[model samples]
Target chain A: MNGNESVAYNLDTEEPGAEELRAGFTALRDRLRQPAGEFVRAKEFLIEKALLVCGMVSILAIALIFVFLFKEGLVALQNASVTDFIYNTSIQYEYDPVADETVAVGESTAYNWQPVGEEPKLSILPLLWGSLSIAFLAAVFSTLIGVAIGIYLSEIARPKIRETVKPALELLVGIPTVVVGFFMLAVIALPLKSFTNWLGLGTIYVDSYNAFIGALGVSLVIIPVIASLVDDALKAVPADLRAASLALGSTRWQMIRRVVLPAGVSGVFAAVVLGFGRALGETMIVLMCAGNAPQMEWNPFLSVRTMTSTIAAEMGAAQQDGIHVQALFLVGALLVTITFTLNVIVEVIVNHYRKKIRL
Target chain B: MSAASRKSLQAVREAVQKGDRAPLWAAIFENIVRGFTIAVVLMLVFILGTIVWEGVPQISWDFLTKAPTDGMREGGIFPAIFGTIFVVLFMILLALPLGIFGAVYMVEYVRNGPMARVIRAAVNNLAGVPSIVFGLFGLGFFILFIGRNLDYYAFGTPRDNAEAQLIEEQLEPLRAQYREEAIAQAKIDELKGKERGDFIRGYVAERMPAQNRKVFGQGAMFWAAATLAILVLPVIIVSTEEALRAVPASMREAAYGLGASKWQVISTVVLPQARSGIMTGAILAVARGAGELAPILFVGVTFFMPSLPLTEPVNFGPLVIQVVNPFQEFMHLNYHIYTMATQHPDPVGTRSIQFGTTLVLIVITFMMNIGAIVLRRRYARS
Candidate 1:
C-alpha cells in the first residue's frame, strides 16, 4: 500500500486498555454519525439535481419550439391530401352552393405564392432546384479547394506558411453568412453578368447569373470549414507511416498520395459530408441570390428557390392552416432529418477511423 | 508504369546526376495553383475596397445625426442608429444570462446520462434551425400578442385623411380658446371613474393617438432583438459549455474538501475561471447578431426609424424605417447597396453604391471576426 494507506492501516490495527478503547469507541461512534462520505454524497446529489435542471431547461426550450411548429403544422395538414399536397401540380378550386362556399379558383397550377395576388405564378420547384443546384455546386467547389488546401497545409506547406494559412482559414467560420451573400449579390454577380455579356455567352445571358454567383459566394464562406476539418483529419494520420514511406525511398508527394491521404480518407470523406450538410442548410446567401423563383427546372442558369428560401420568403404570410404554411414546415422537417442523418453518419465514420488509427 | 519500375528508374536517374532546378512542369503547376489561391484572397479584398470607396464618401456626422425626411429620399439615419443599438443591447441582456446559466447547469451538475445526452443533442439541432423560422414565430407570438395590445388596444388610431388635417389646423385656435371647457370635461370623466391621482386625471386629456407612422414599421426593433437573441443562443451555449467543461475535476474536489457547498464551488471556483470563455462567446454572439438580415424583414425593421422624441408616440414612417422595410423601401447600407445594384431606378448610381456597401460590410465583418478570434484564442490558451 502507499504511505498514507499504511499509516491508516497501522492506526486501525493497534489495541489499547479498556478505558482507552471506551474513549476511542465513543469518538468512533461520533465520527460515524457524521461521515465525510455523507457530505460528499449530498454534494454529488445536488450537482446531479443541477445537471437535471439544466437538461430540463434545454428540453423545455426545444419542446416549446416543436409545440409551436406542430400546432400550426397540424392545422395546415388537416385539409391537405397526400396527392393534392405534393403531386396535384396545382391548387384546386371548388364551389359549394349548399354552404354558399366559393373556394379559391386557381387554375393551371400556377405554382406561385403572391398572397396579395401580386405575382400569380408561384412555383416552389424552381427555387428548390436553385437551392440544390447552388448548394451542390458550392460543395463541389469547397471540397476540391478545401481538400487541396488541407493537404497543402498538413503535408506540403512549410510550418510558417501552414501556421498563417490555418488560422486565416479558421477565421472564415466567424463571418456572418449575410455579409457573404451581400458581397456576392452586389460585387460578384454584377461583374460576372457584365463579363458574360461581354463574352457574348447566350447561356449566361439566358440563365441566372445570380444563382452561379451565389454558389461561388457560399463556396468562399465554407472553404475554411472544409479546409480546417480536412486538415484535422490529415494531421490524424500517424507520423510513423510517413517516416516508413520515406525510408522506402518514396518522394514526399508520393508518400502523401499513397500513405497519408489514403489513411486519412475517412476523415476527408466525413469532412465533405459535414460541409455538404452545412451548404444545404445555409439560408441567407440563397435567399438573397436565388431570385426567389419557385418552379422546378434542371437548368442552372434559371433563377430558382430552395426549401430554405421558400420558408424565409413565405413563412411571413402563410396562414396557420394554409397548404403553403404546412409545406414550409414539412420542408423544414425534411431538412432537419437530412442534416441529422448526415451528422450521425459523419460521427460514425470519424469514430471508426479513430478506433482504427488508435491515436 | 509499375511502382517497382518507377523506383528503379528514380535510382538510376539519381545515380546519373539530376538537375538542381525543379522540373518546369512542376514549377509551372505550383505557380498556377499558388496564383489561384492568391487570386481568391484578392477577390475578397477587392470587394471590401469597393464598398469603402463608395460608402465612406457618403458617411458623415450629419448623415449619422439628422433624422430622415421627405420620403427618406433625403438625409440621415439617426433613428436607425439608436434603434439598432437598443435592439442589440436588449437582445444581449436577454440571451447572456440564460445561456450562461444553462451552460453552467449542463457542465457542473449533470452526470453522463441518457436524458442529458438527448437534451444536448436536441439543443445542437435547434441551433441549425433557420433564423427566418424564428422570425415567423416572433410575428405570431410577439407582434400579434404583445404589439397588438400596445399599439392598437391601448392607443387610439390617429386620423389619416386630408379632411382631418384641415379640421386640426382650423380647430387648434378654437380649442385653445376653449381650454377651460376641455379641462372641465376631462375632470368630470376622471371623477366618474373615481380616480385618486392627478396623473390619471391628466392622462385622459393628453393621451395622443398612436402614430400612423413608425420608426421602422410596426414591431421591428423588438422582433429584430428577439430573432437575434434566438440566433446567438446556440453559439453562446455551446461555447460556454465547452469552457465550463474545461475546468479541472480536481478543482471541484478540492473545493468540496474544504467543506464548500456545490453551489459555492461553482460560483467561486468554476465561474471565475470560465469568465474569458464566456466573454469570448458573447463577443462572437454580437458579431453574429450584426450580420443577420432575414428576421429583420418580418419585424418592423425599417432602414431608419424616424427620429422622434422618445416621449412622442413611436412612429416608423421615416427614412430610417424605409431602410429596413423590404416590402416598400430599402435603406441600411447593405439593403441600399443591394437595391442600387439590382433594383435601382437608375443604373449609373447602382454600380458605385453596390461596390461601396460591399466593401464596408466586408471590412466590418472582418474586423468583428478578428476581434472574436483574438478573444477566443486568449481564452483557449488560459
Candidate 2:
C-alpha cells in the first residue's frame, strides 16, 4: 500500500486513474509477499553487522594484545619495581639471602640486561639505547635518501623517468626483511667489515653484526616507506606555488627548495616519524644483524640489541610464566606504547596537513 | 637602430645568458639529489644481482624437487617452499573476505562517523605494531589460549604439557648419543679419508622411535596462518578500501535510480567495478604474507620439518589415508634461511643453500607483487 501511494503520487501527472489502479493492485500483491521483504531486510542487517564487526576486529585485536601483554608483564613489574625496572642499568636481580627472593642490591646500580643469570638483571635502558640508536641512524639515513628521491621524483625528474622510477622504488617495499637480514649477514657485513678495516681506522673495530650494519639493513626497509610517503606529500604541494616562484625569477631548484619544501614540511615530518616508527619496530633485520648483545653504548660499530630483536630471539626459548618471559613481554609492551604513540602523532600531523592543504 | 640602443641590447643578452646559468651550489645540490635517487635504484639492482649471482647456480631441477638432506646442509628446500605456499594460501583465505567486508563497511556503509574513525585508527596502529609483537601475540593468544582451549575441549583435558615436556626431555639423551656417534663417525671418516657422517646419522636415527619425534600443543601451522592473517589484514583492508573508494558515485546513483536497494547496488554495481582492485589487494596481501617471517617464528616455523604438512598414504594401496592436518609443525623458506644462517653447525658451508632459499622466496614474492601490480595497471587503464 505504501509503494502504491508513492507510485500513484508520481503517476498523477501522467495517467491518473488506470495507472494508479493497476499500480495499487500490484503493490497489494507485493505486500502479500512480506516474508521475502523481511528475508531481504534480515540478510542486509546480517551483512551490515558482519562488516561492522570485521572493521572493529583490529581494535579488538589491539586491545586484546595490550591486555595479554600487561597481564604477563605486570607480574614481573611487581617483583622488579617500575623505577628499577626502567632506570637500573643492569637487569641482574640480586637475591636476598634472608628473604629468599630476588631483590635490588649494591650501592652503585649497574646497567646490564642479563635476564638469565644467577641474579637476573631486567634493566631495559641498554635495550632502549640500542633500539633508539639504531632507529635514529636508520631514520637519518632513510630520510635523507628518501626525501631526496621524493624531491627528484616530484620536482626534477622528467615524466617518463618518474613513471619508470616510481614503481621501481615501490618494488623495494616488497623485499622481505628476512632477505635484507640475510643479505646483510651473508653479503654485506663481511665486505663492510673488511672495508672498514681497510680504511685503517685504529681502535675502531667494526663487529660483523654491529649497530651500524643493523641500521643499514633497517634503512633499506624504511627507505621505500619514507620515499613513497614523502613523494605523496611533495606531490600534494600546489603547482601554483612552484609556478609563482619560478615567475618571480627563481630557478627550478630555488622554487622547489623555498616554495614546495616549505609547503610540504609537515608532510615530510610525518613521513620521517612514520619511518622512525617502522625502523623502531622492525624485528627480523635487527635480530639477524644487530648482534644480540644488550649494552649501553652509542658506538655504531659495537654490537647492540634492540627491543624487537630481544623479544624475537628470547621469546621462543623463554620458559612460560618465568621472569624472563614476563620481562620480554614488558619489553613488547614498551614497544607497543612507543610505536603506537608515534603512529598517532604521525597520523594527526598528516591529517592536519591534509586539512590545511584542502582549505 | 641607434649605436647606444644596440650596446644596451647586447648587455641585456649577456645578462640573460648569465641568468640562464644556475648557481653552482644549486647545481651540486640537484646532482646530489639525483645521485641519491640513482642510489636507491642501484641498491635494488645490487641486492637482486648478488642473490642471483650466488643463488642461480644452486637451483637445479633436483634442487627444486628433492627434500633437504644432511641436516639441511644438502639437497633442496622443497618442504620450506611448500610450507610457505600452504601458509600463504591459508592466510589469504582467512584475511581476504574479512578485509573486503571491513573495507566495504568503511567505504559504503559507514561515512565519517566516530566508529569509522576508530576503525581507521585501529588499522593504522595495527600497521605500526612490530612484527615481533605479532609473534608474541600469536604465541600468547593463538597458541597458549585458543589452542590450549581447543585441546582441552577436544581431548577432554588440558593438553598434557608434562607429556610434551617428557617427550622433549627424552630427545636430549638421544641427541647427545647421536652427537657422540657423529663425533666417533667423524674420526672414522677422517682416518679413512672419506665422508660417512650421513650414513652414521641415518644409522643412529633408525634406532629412534617415531613416538619420540611427535610434538604438540605449541608451534602449529594453523596458529601461524592465523597470526599471518591478522598481520596482513591491514594491508588488505587499506588497499580494498582504496579500491572501493575509487568506484564512481555515479554507478551507485544509477543503481539507486533503478530502485535498487543499497545492498543490491553494492552487490551488483560497486563490487563488480571494484573486483579487479579487490583482486589486486588480495594478491598484494598474499605477497606480504609470503614474505613475513617474524610472526611465524614462534607460532609454528621449524628449522627442519622432514615430512610434508599432509601425511602421506600410510599403506601405498588402493585405500589410503590422506589427512590434511593443520596442527603440524612446518618449515618455511624465511625461517630456513634464518636457521641455516644462524643455527647451522657450519654457516659458511650452508651459504649456497641460504642464498638459494632466499632467491626462491624473493622470486615467489616478486611474482605475486608483479601479478597484483599488473592487474592494477590494467584495471586502472580501463
Candidate 3:
C-alpha cells in the first residue's frame, strides 16, 4: 500500500491521503483478524472445554450412582458375611448337646427376604423372583398388545386414527406411575379380588394384592412405552421395502410379516429389551399393590415383593445407616446394574439395526 | 435371504396367486390389530375418564386453595401444588443449562466421532437408569455427602433450625435493649477493652443453635430438584440434540461466511433456530421430572407438611416478595397421592381427596407433555 501510494504521488502530486488509506486498510485487516486474538481464543477454548465437561456428565452420573450405591450398600458387608447376605432363611439347624455348637447341617436353598425380623434375612432371591415374574408377566401381556398396536399404527391404521391415537398413547405414557399405583391400590385390587372370588378363582389367586394384580398394574404403565417404541421401530422400515412387497403381489399381512417385520426385528428386540428393563425397575405400582410378602414362590397368583418395591417401601423406614438401608441400597445397585446392562444391549442392537436398515 | 424368509416369500406368492383366502384372512388379521390399537386407546380414555370423573367433583375452589385437614381427608392440596412447582422450577433451571450445553457440544462441536458415540451411550444409559436408583443416589450422595459437608463446613454443627430461630428471636430484644447501645456507647467512650469484646462475642454465640436439628445434611427441595435434574437430563439432551441436528448446515456456513466465530455463529444462528425445540425439551423434561415421586421420596418430600414451602415474605421497604426456600423438605402431589393410598389410617375415606390430588397431578403432566409434543410437531413442520 505504501509503494502504491508513493507511485501515485510520483504520477500526480495529488490526493495525498494515501498514507491514511494505507493505515485504514491495515486497521481493517487487524479488525478481521482471521487468526483471532488471544482473549477471544481463550474464551472460546474455555467455553468449549466447559461444554465438553457438561456433555460428559451422563457418564460421570452413571459412575457416581454406581459409586454411591456401592458405598452405602457395602455397609451391610461390614455387619454380615457374603454367604449370609446370599443365603438366608428356612435353614433348620440341629444343636448337638455333645458338640455344643449349633451347627450340624441344613440346606441353604431357601431364599427369604425378611430384612427386619429377629434374625434379619437378606437373601435377594425372593426379590429377584418377584421382579422377574412380574416383569415377565407384564412383558408378555403388554408386548402382545403393544406390538399389535404398533403393527396397526405402522401398517393398517387410517391416517386420522393414527394421528389421534399416537399422541394419546404418548400422553398415556406420560401419566405418572404414582397415579397408576393409586389406581391399582384403591380402584383395581379389591374389586378384582372380589370378582375373582365370585368366580371361585380367588383361592388360587390368593389375595387382593397378588402378583397378578401388580403385574397387570405395571403392564398398564409399560404398555404405552412398548407401543411407542415398536411403532417407531416399524415406522423406521424403509418405505420402498413396503412398496416393493406390495408390488410383488403379496397381501398386506404378508408384506408386514415377511418384509417389514423382518427388517425391523432387531428394533423390536431393542424395544422389548427396553420394555423389560422398564418393567423390572418399575417401583410405585408394585410397591403399592404387590402385597410385599417377600415370599420366594414364583406363583403369579400369590403375593410377592420385587426388588424395586423393597427399596421404595422400606428405604424410608430403614435407619439411615442401618443394615436395612444397606440392603435396600444393594437391591437398588443390582437393579441399576441390570437396567444399565440392558440399555447397553439395546444401544448395540439399535446401532446395528440402524446401520443395516437406513438406506 | 434366509431360508425361512425365502419360504415365506414363496408362500406369499402362492397365496397371492390363489387370492381367495389371503385377502379375506389378511383383512381379518388387520382388523384384529386395529382392534388392539383401539382397545389400547379406549383403555387409556377409560382410565383418564375414571380419574377425571371421580376427581373433578371432589375438586372445588376450596380444594385448590386450602390445605388438608383431618388427617388429609378434609381439605385441599395447596402445599403439594406449591412444592411440586418449586421442585419443577429448580429442576428445569438446573437441567436446561446442562442439557442444552451438552446437546450443543454434540451437535455443534462433536458431530461424529468416538467421543460422540461414547456420549450417546452415556446418555442412553442415564435415561434408562431406574428412577428408584436415582433415589438411592439422591440419599447417598446429595443428602449424606453434599448436604452433610455443607452443614459441617458452614454451620459448624448439626443443630436445630427452630432453636436457632428461637435464639435469634430471643436475642432480638436483648440487642435492641442493650448490645447495640452498649457497643455504640463503648465506641463513643473510646473504651477499647476486653469487656466490650467479650460482650460482643457472647452476644453472637447466643444465636448459635443449642439443640439438635438436621439442615442441608438431610432431605431438602434443592437436593431433590438436583436429583431430578439428573433424572431428566437425557430427555432434554436427546430432544435438543435432534433439534440442533435439524437446523440446516447452510445457515451455520453462512454465519461463518459473514466473519462470525464458531460460538458467535452458534449463538446467533443455530440456537435461535433451535429455540422452540429447546423449549419443548425443557417443558417435557420438567413434566417428566416433576411427577416422579421416587427421587423426591426420601430426598426431600415430606408426607405431611401443613405449610407451603415458601420463605417468609421479604419487605423491601415498600415492596415485598416471597420465594420458595429450597432447603426445606416439602410435600409433593405425587407423594401425597402415594401416602394417601397406602399410608392413610383410612384409605377408603381419603379416596376422594386422593383422586382430587391425582387429577391435579395428571392434568399438569398431561398438559406439559401434550403441549411439548404439539409444539415439536408444529415447529418441525414449519
Point out the worst 10-residue segment of candidate 2 chain B by lDDT.
Answer: B208-217
Model 3: per-residue Cα lDDT over B231-279, one tens digit each: 9999999989998998999999888876678999889999999999989
Steric clash pairs (candidate 3): B159-B213, B160-B213
True interface contacts reproduced, per candidate: 0.29, 0.70, 0.77
How much is B190 displaced in model 3, in angstroms? 45
DockQ, prediction 1:
0.25
Show the lowest summed lDDT stretch of 10 residues, model 1 chain B.
Answer: B321-330
DockQ-sorted candidate list, best first: 3, 2, 1
Q: Please give the CA lDDT of all the candidate structures.
A: 0.64, 0.85, 0.84
DockQ of each: 0.25, 0.49, 0.52
Ranked by TM-score, the better of candidates 1 and 2 is 2
Off by over 4 Å in 2: A1-36, A87-106, A201-204, B1-22, B156-216, B311-323
Model 3 misplaced stretches (Cα beyond 4 Å): A1-35, A89-109, B1-19, B158-213, B318-320
The better candidate by DockQ, 1 or 2, is 2
Model 3 lDDT tens row, A160-232: 8888998888887888999988888887888888887888885655777878988888888788888888889
Top of the candidates by TM-score: 3
